[model samples]
Target: MLKTTSQVRALTPDDLPELHLLLDRDPLVNLFVRNRVDSTRLQARWLGGQVWGYFEDGVLVSACHAGTNLVPVQATRKALRAFAERVLGDNVRPSSIVGPRDAVLPLWELLEPRWGPARSPRLAQPFMVLDRDSRLTPDPRVRPVLIDEFDTIYPACVAMFTEEVGVDPEAGSRSGYRARVAQLISQGWAFAIIEDGQVLFKTEVGAATPQACQLQGVYVHPDLRGRGIAGPALSAVVRLVRQTVAPVVTLYVNDHNTPARRAYERVGFEHTETFASILL
Candidate 1:
């Protein structure tokens, strides 16, 4: 194994170039961090998280974002071990650990004893991406959500979050969660198909940078699902994202969600990588 005086430290704006280079090595998979980096660089508060770098002879080899979510990028066995040790000792408790399957699983294995069992471990999430316009026709009804629609959209957003994450977004208080939904709408990142103030389908461009944007919180009302709605709605969202937000759109789906997987395939998404998440 390559050996040098390994040093791990919190990254700062001065490390931007090195960090950007490392993250760009796998831009699609690293979109989560790259989006934050593009907006806030190496600020400790970027996306409410701090980034740490593992350096060998002053060259960054691996990096991790520790906060609401734990994401390790390009971490080798040594780097993962070091990160696990560092975060465990510091008493940092992230809500979840997510990343490329190969990296997340091993990192979770190292930290599980210290962090306790995850509430759920999603071991196979196909990280899919789309660069070209979708093959399916875009849904004419789906459009960017208006700021005035936050009240109508909030419930759907909460429901989707709870269903997907297995925890109510409004469990503690609705104010904070409500504000987040409004923010996405204000930023023109929220989209939905609504009629009579009822959200039929909804989603958001949860994270973005010039190179790519990630789609999240995709939900079609229970009453509206399985009737050929998601495929075209998603294609519309993908089209809007490619036209106005970024050229590339990416999302990860639970491997077991064969229907969603097929729907995305119908929309022109292809599996680019695999991801895993240890939800705490």
Candidate 2:
């Protein structure tokens, strides 16, 4: 007999080891890579409603996690419904819920229709994956943010978010976003291309694991695209990451983003998986 329960809940620190192994073993997870997660980070992320998992025999077997940018469109939908029905007992509404691709899918598949068309897919944004290898060279001008560059780097970070994620890092205060940028700068996590006197290109390593670092907020100014900038700029960022963290780097791109994908491939990234997002 197959047994199941929605009483299952979000992953806890104690479940980290098991969850990590389960995620690592899944081929689909190769797109995100599994090493970036640990107990503490998972807890913080989960508390934000970005993660949920299922356990069996005291070991975490299945989990669907979401990030700030992408939610699990299918998995989360399934997991949440199962949880609500078995644990909450039908007190919740039947309306569709959406979030990042990784966060929602587990819930989406828990009942029936394990795989089907997305109810509300974010078609404009497609999932992309990049693998790190030595294909391009780092730009001499591009380097990690230094202690003195916060004033300038801060604005660039905000501009990156506005262009990439479509929301201000602070949602309002430009200064607040600056402060958040400052934090990443201090940690040696942010990078930029400095030419003459201004920033030209930039990207951030959103989640870094021993296995891989997920690239996020990659952007070049509108006029700067196809100017032989992205190739070297991305090369520099990936090179730096290989030096400090995982040698493999990855990022999600929209399926329709042909140009970006080509640029990434030129810099030594490969497509490893397809991911869909749910927006509720």
Candidate 3:
């Protein structure tokens, strides 16, 4: 009897159908990859990196999105090792590694020797999701950031980013980070509550698809923290997101963030999966 040999290779446009099927296996958890492929269709030129696929008997079983952010898609144990090996062989140094805890942790374990001393090795993050309207009343003050308020919202964006990622996004490229904030507002993806020209609360809808959308950069003004703001603010974001964006909303938070986790739970997000992130 012949055994099904396993192999890993860079996926191409011709492999998109199989890729879509793999992504569909869990749209909520795989939203990031789904959104990327939807826009780039697995094209390396457009993707800025390759989509590495693990094949068993010539059939794709798992995939990894290799770019500035390395993310795994439905990776099995063998697939995880294969991905790590493939990445190591190619000497890919992504800015961050993020995805399922089971997959990302193992994948990182394989790469850590060569890629040790990550800036932040967050081994456990709760991948929470919300499919229905938020339980709390949506804060009317929370709304899509207006394009004219770009200047007003820009500083808050930088603050949120720096605080969350532990790095100043503007350090690498001020214009680049500024442009991203503007783009989110222009797409109606940036949400915030502003009072007297001050940003009180803010968040952005990152990667999204028809099935699900993921949130990022959620923040409440430092002065406004510890005043029962997060729950209501997130409730507003979740409600607005479900209405205009996708029915399902998802976000992963560091496991140690008890306050944020409690806030998300109060707003109706339930932990459905575990995620891990290795920041470089």
Report lDDT (CA) for all predictions.
0.91, 0.60, 0.91
Q: What is the TM-score of each predicted model, taking all chains together? A: 0.97, 0.74, 0.97
TM-score attained by model 1:
0.97
Worst 10 residues of 3 by lDDT: 107-116
Q: What is the Å distance of residue 197 in model 1 from its true position?
A: 1.0
**lDDT for model 2:** 0.60
Candidate 1 lDDT, tens digit per residue, 148-170?
Answer: 87789988998999999999988
Query: Stretches of candidate 2 above 4 Å error?
Result: 1-6, 26-51, 56-59, 66-80, 83-121, 124-132, 172-176
| Cα error, candidate 1, residue 26 (Å) | 0.7
TM-score between model 3 and native: 0.97
lDDT of 2 by residue, 12-99 (tens): 6776666666666643343342433552456674344435565454545455443433223133344455453442342332223333
Model 1 is weakest, by summed lDDT over 10 consecutive residues, at 40-49
Candidate 1 vs candidate 2: which has greater lDDT? 1
